[model samples]
Target: MLSWRRSTSATAPGSSLAYGCADFLGGPGARKAHVLRTVMVAAPAGLAVELLLWPVLGASFSGAPLGWGAASGAASAAAFALLHRTLAIGPMNVLSPVTALVSAALPVGVALLHGEHLGAAGLVGLPLALVAVVQVGAGHGAGVARPSRTALLLAFGAGTAIALQLIFLHQAPSDSGVAPLITGRAVSSAVTLAAAGQMHRRLGAERPAYAMSAAASVLDSLANLLFLLAARNGDLTVVAVITALYPAGAVLLARGVLAERVHRGRLIGLGTAAVAVSLLALT
Candidate 1:
């Protein structure tokens, strides 16, 4: 769960869709610690889901790649913690886009380094995707306050961490099934618990908050499971870019649930991202 201050005026458009999703999870008092705590609590539930679905999905597992999965989970936890913290403490508009761009770019770079070729369409679409991410990250309206440099750096680092997590997960063998995901959830939970302890935050006496956190955790786990499956069979570049469009879901949520106005800039960015993703798929 993540939360931040909401702007009163429509002129601001305040948080981006990513932050909007966080808002749903944590509400106005949502901060870095709360977000981490939610993730920590959700880990076990996510693991359970993976285990339950394994038999139905007919997924097989091997212990050999558990280490890789654990590593990926650790990186993912770190990324989420850092990213939520950045979002909580900084401008959502700027940080979200910066993080999204880096998250998308790194996997593509990794794919290229591994001799994965991007056809002409992919080459063109890559830049377009970057541009779209930037547009979405920038505030929805003119005259918006600029995001701090520290926030930008934090977001970038978070995105890199997420990229590493994705790359590692992609390396897992298909037969490994959701075992890596389970390993990742366990690792992330432990790390987040430690972080919560250090911060001296207690997840107590807030029933609604707990419920929201639990929901977020379940959704996040499902997302991770699906992503792992997708990356296993698809090109990492394609999967990463497509997955990076998750903020668009946040935007839609914001509009429908929060009644937030979707400005032209964001709409354009989202539309551009859709086109860019389509191009990537074709390539």
Candidate 2:
């Protein structure tokens, strides 16, 4: 059910025709619609795939790890809603990386609290990650409006939910496999997506809106699969860090195809994030 294909914008062959067509037919609104559809489709599909992969943990379905994951996802969605309204920041540019950073840090901190000795490499990655986060945040400030106090707290709450979700994923029985974990993700995502649909209805849905959500949903599903696989098989901290780099993907796509100009600082921060990804993965 993966509809997303890898296509480059600048250097890829057969770009001129598509670019001309999009320029002729798909304007800014078309792009916005694309983004919205991507969200709706990818978010739900991603969750479903994750749940399908993770075996349910605990006896009762609601008592399983998926349940808690669903809860965490709901919390995250709420946080997103708050941000969309109050902060006016877009999802990929601001929300995705921020959540990824918090999710990565949380598990590491939790592991330490549980008396797990982090490798020296992990210890080193921590401060570098912190610096990377600050840089990303500073970069985001250029295009997006500053979050108000309420929006900031709510956004933090979203990050907390994601962090807790990862922590719980790590805490879940290893034998639980992919079914339960992916199920949890699916449930959470379903709730969030349904809510988003409602919000869109209220906000007014247009052609571009539908397309963007559809695209996001597809991307989200793919990301979800990658993250779930990474989490189940790899170190949670490392997995979280790598997945957090998704924003860079979005930014690059925007710049390349959409021709959206990024602030230099944001570009630098994203570059810093890329370095952090390399360092975290190696460690």
Candidate 3:
């Protein structure tokens, strides 16, 4: 009986040790799944809220070509899914700022192509924004630790997707009364759901994960609706730049909830971005 007890105790520890290693290796994949699932839940909820508010907000449905919006929504969903995946296993400090810069710059370039000239301040701000991206990409400390190539690539893709989303949203007809947004959200949700399914894993097993996912979905939908409205009435450059400041919220949340350390380089990069946004706004 004593020998059996000893053998059982030894087996338990070995099993636990194996479990720990498996958990660590699988962490990234699990996190990716969680993020995608959150998006799936959040997007549909957001769409519902937008639909409910449409009539109250006096939005009218104009017959607009929805191809661009649908395409943009699919792209955005893919980008966001990738972004969350990167953030799960990569450096948030690096990804957030780089993504923000790309998101802001692309719309500005589009605006310029459309004959929207920048003022002196905007001209100056553009360079500063680029510099900020570089600084953030260079790492957030004295040693200048850069993110993995995969992470950087993911960040770039995310930004590009955001820019496309904003640009396409602007193309929506003025009379479309939130229909484009609804269409876009639907597409995004569908894409996200497909991605989650492709993972072949269970989603939101934890209560907290479900709650956070729901909250994120509501906020994301609200943000998308606002961006559509803003882009419809304003310059795409101006609106995109304003919206790109979203990373600031994420940064703060990371600091508060995760207690992540913000090194000097990150601070400098973030500051530069703030100044650039101010100048862009002034221009």
Candidate 4:
């Protein structure tokens, strides 16, 4: 079970969802070692995929995106390591709160920096993005607690990577192709796994944790791929904001599978986030 400083996230709704999925898939048990292995291999694969896709997408190919991608990737890897170490320190609700918020707003900052005018849609989504974040916090508060300093720092670092990714995506040359982006996903997955391996050894995780971590890496890559596709097809603001609902997906998974407690706050938070999404998109 993934422990936090103050919270036990093993039974967290999000955790439950993942556990249930593994059980449903009937592939393996949800042990720490398994989670770790899953994370180690799958995470970097996602990044590698993104890197390869950028060139094919016809976007202005530049090393700048890769540079920033590396930084963000490192930050994310650090975050995962921290999560493993501080599993017993904080609540899943607490740890996951601001990540999406940071991610959702990052693209807007990138667009503005690049002098892309914010449309009405952009204006609408901004506030909803905040609301959505609040919902995540409320929903996960039940068994959550304050994280260790290391966890907090890692969380911030992860947020930074996510934000940087959005900026890079926004700044990617208009003519950029999707090939490199996909390639990046695969490469990054490998990188993440290596980092996870180092951390696994440090933490001495068991088999189940390794598997879960591996699964997380793969899923995270798929999520990134979806985000890229969404960006390719939809407005940045819309795509970013909608995908920010990922934590909600994680939370929902917990409710159905882990038999974890779902707080009313989560319902309200999700509802608020939904309202924000609708308002943001419509505007």
Candidate 5:
């Protein structure tokens, strides 16, 4: 919970935590079931959260917001399908950094084109942010098969789609409220359910991750909500960079909950991320 004026200071970290927790659960859930089937749980759960938030936030029917929401839904659907597919089949060491780096870069590029500058502290923080993401991503899931041409394309596409989802949500008018989120989640859910229905036989045979998926979906939706607020209240470049630090959170969660060792690179990344955030916030 953050006031609109203070949200920029708080929401980015809040969003990062939500995203981290979501990925933590979503990763294991995907391993248990088909990733798309896990999305079946996420779709409805996320949609329900948006619907609940809609009334509290207030919304209006507007063509621009609605169109942007639908576009975001499509991008989100593509990202969820592609990124996980790539990770499932390709080398995590190479492709994960590709996705993470591209996603962080695209939003900052857009923000620059829109004349939003990160200023002096941000200049230093920006490169650190990029380095942090690389370290965070590269430290995990090592030594799978090298990425194929198809996997490379999918990783890049997933990154672009993720960036587009954030940009589209950022484009929604402030007065439009959470309607865009509701519309986007509803569209994505319907698409995911249709895909899951087709794989019902396969999904049925696999272990279900109902509770885990639901919790992840809820947290992911909340993260998006917090991100939208932060973007609205602050420079897009700043918020996007901070939000991309989510992998650091995931790594930390893994250390605490799963008793996994935090590799040196990820530990450095997490520490770097903390310093970058402090500098970005202060100046």
Candidate 6:
């Protein structure tokens, strides 16, 4: 059984935490001040972090890495857009699980096809983890709309883009360091800004929570960095599945900081997640 691979320095768990914090900080602001407007701040904020780290990390902007970075950037931007649109059309509880499933399942399938195996512990833990991700996102409010075909389509699209972003970032060469992220973040920032400009009227006087957006972006950047490192050192299937449990982190954070009520389903999810992580650690 794959209990969190100690060999990877718990990078997957670190990624999950960072991702959860990013979502927690970003989610409210996006919902309140238009997703695109919040993203305008988030994207640039991430770019600034990457720019600062690029030189220290020893960036080498080669063709393949740059291409992958750009692709990842475009995919991330698409994911943000599609995710918000899908949520607007449907409930988060109804649509989020689908997106989360696709994002994890696709990468797991690809990793398996490429000859990565999870062994016994991983086999036991992975399913539980995936289930935990869905359960953790279960809601007491919002997500009241019945999921229609359009919402399903958008959810699937967003998930696909999210998967692609991860895959693209992982595909960058080892020596590429954080250079690819710099390129990727810059591209996403430019695209987000342009979209925000086009939809400025939608923003009206609803200014984004700049500090929260920037904090979220920094957390997201850290998560991506950790994910890339974990993917490089561990089986993609294991790392991706583990990292996808990020929703649990967000839920707990909301409960603690915002005093949001946790549903019974999510409490069970947290319990299951603890079990899953314990099992995966043996791997």
Maximum-TM-score candidate: 5
Top-down TM-score ranking = 5, 6, 1, 3, 4, 2
lDDT of 2 at 105: 70
Per-residue lDDT value at 35 in model 4: 48
Give the alpha carbon lDDT tens digit for every residue of 66-169 in model 5: 98888888888888888878877778788887888888899999999999876799899988888888888875555455778898898898889898998898
Residue 64 alpha-carbon offset, candidate 4, angstroms: 6.5
For candidate 4, the clash count comes to 105
Q: Model 4: runs farther than 4 Å from truth?
A: 1-31, 34-36, 41-72, 82-88, 117-124, 139-151, 174-176, 196-205, 209-216, 233-235, 258-261
Candidate 6: deviation at residue 269, Å? 1.0
95-195, model 1: which lDDT tens digit per residue?
A: 77778889889998898798887788888877887787777666665337677778778998999998898888888876676777777877877888787
The alpha-carbon deviation from the true structure for residue 109 of candidate 2, after best TM-score superposition, in angstroms, is 1.9
The residue pairs found clashing in candidate 3 are 42-217, 62-175, 62-176
Count of backbone collisions in candidate 1: 0
For residues 53-93, write the lDDT of model 2, one tens digit per residue: 33432222445655555554655456445534433444334
For 176-231, candidate 4 gives per-residue lDDT tens digits of 34543543554455666565667765645454444444555445544544454445
Runs of candidate 6 exceeding 4 Å displacement: 1-9, 141-145
Tell me which of candidates 1 and 3 scores higher on lDDT. 1
The superposed Cα distance between candidate 6 and the true structure at residue 8, in angstroms, equals 2.9
Q: What lDDT does candidate 1 reach at residue 23?
A: 36
TM-score, one value per model: 0.82, 0.66, 0.73, 0.67, 0.94, 0.92
Q: Cα miss at 233, model 6 (Å)?
A: 0.8
